[model samples]
Target: MTQPVHPPKPRPGDRVAVLSPSSGLPGLLPLPFELGLARLREDFGLVPVEYPTTRRMGSSPRERARDIHAAFADPGVTAVIASIGGDDQITVLPHLDRELIRANPKPFFGYSDNTALHCYLWNTGIVSYHGGSVMVELGRPGAMAPLTADSLRAALFTSGPYELRAADRFRVVDRDWADPATFEAEPETDPGDGWLWHGPERVVEGRSWGGNLSVLSWLLMADREISQDLSAYDGGVLLLETDEELPSAEEVFRILRAMGERGLLERFDALLMGRAKTWSFDRPGDHAERARYARDQREAVLRALAVYAPDVMAVFDVDLGHTDPQLIVPYGGLVRVDGPARRITVTY
Candidate 1:
């Protein structure tokens, strides 16, 4: 197969499918979901069309797949964005009709559990997106982060080189989304620490690959979505980020070790690791604890690179994943990492 194809962009007035390809959290948490819908209409000027399973918690994989098929097959729907990310989107992958999705290729936007969908779309030879979930970025408490809003707008409505900036102020702490007050202001954030780079100073420009590290591990285990001919990913930029579950540094290293064992780690010459989310309800670590967690995770990543991808250029703290201001990274699209210049840019 050749490089992935970039699907047409959606217009401001176009109708975008707001389906829950992952969790129907929108059903359980309507506060953020409804707020997100209103933004799509009032702010983005796009009509959000919801599917049956979009808000129905515990819907079957086949039911979700049906909604996806319906949305893509509908010419009225210009783009499809997930309501939110969740666990078990991998189960919904097998239910998807590849031929149908490939035939009616429209841009699909999501991350986390939606990483399953991203890999699927990449395999389908259609470029998808790695961020811009309704319940997350669009429905962000207080207001959408300016950087996130601009990045998403470019990905949704335009096409070209989009340089990604390091977050001056980033957040890792979480609050009760169920509380009405949570929507009244932005989530508490820690002081900004710009990206860290490792490896020789060089420029690596190629199509982007990789997604939520945990999701990739599941896909690797299930032998799903990954190209049998690993050479297809040679020279592609690898994107890695951990979710709110906050997998141990050991687990993160193990996943990369598995990839190294498969000779997959060396395929990409560059990597952009999203800023790690160090806190969660399960592990509510304080400032010092958060710093320690982030440090350990970084060390784990560097260890993996040293063992398998020694020559690969790496940048840490990319604002493209589970954080206050998540930027859109085009799945299977061109990404240029300029090490000497300390810059990263993606083609939307």
Candidate 2:
């Protein structure tokens, strides 16, 4: 297995390249995107430099690749972050210059469809962040989640073990970004339930792998990004979560069952399951429906683990992926899952 290289840290005044490797929603919706950029400058004290394709809709894969190459190769660019993630980043991966990115490794932050690039970085042996998209978390309707702010702050500036904590409160509903009134107050949140753990008493420590389970399933079908030798993932920690699409619990079970059939399920010593996203704009679910959704999804995950990797240490409801107050998980970086101590830590 290739060990990952940590990129140089960005200081307050440094320039951070912000690009849209997937859909350039920044062009269509300037409200969240502009707010996000402002926060990067004022709150984080970093300058965000945009590329030609950063806000352009329908940008070609090669055009996106050029932007990535420019961002990474530029001496002034200390780090690279995505404006937001979209569905087709997998198409941009083949166009990337691996050597250029490898030579100028810097922290890349994104989740959801950005899983394509995260998997790409993992293959290149460079650690990248799996949360804190500019247009999503930072540009949230109200304000950045306090937990999210703390996690991003630590991930951007520090290089050490950071303990993961469950958010005291969490939000799943999104307000209209076009309405200026939406930004004036905080979003409603539900009380957080702490993490649920299962399996053996032993602690598992190793480099982390995996992201957005739906995206991983797609990669597995295409036979792209993931290693052919499943042993490469042995002893590694697997982090996974479902997105706002709100796939049924049966669908979740079937995906894990397929992974088990491929001999992929047993490769990891531990699994970190991000809290299942229960609500979407089109399908506005009630509180009871949302609770049922979360419960069913958790059951599906446990069902698969029981059949395929019974002894694997597992933790549920981790604040990563589609949920609010997201914590950044380091892709291809160190993760320590202490089952007995009920603690999780990742190097960011």
Each candidate structure's TM-score, on Cα atoms with residue i matched to residue i, is: 0.99, 0.98
Model 2 clash pairs?
none
Worst 10 residues of 2 by lDDT: 172-181
TM-score of model 2 relative to the true fold?
0.98
Q: Can you write out model 2's per-residue Cα lDDT over 171-234, one digit (the tens) per residue?
A: 9787877777887888899999899888897889988888988888888888889898899899
Model 2's C-alpha root-mean-square deviation from the true structure amounts to 1.0
Each candidate: what lDDT?
Answer: 0.92, 0.91
Off by over 4 Å in 1: none
lDDT per residue (tens digit) for residues 76-188 in model 1: 89999999989999999999999998989999999989999999999999999999999988998988888999999999999999899887888777778799989998877
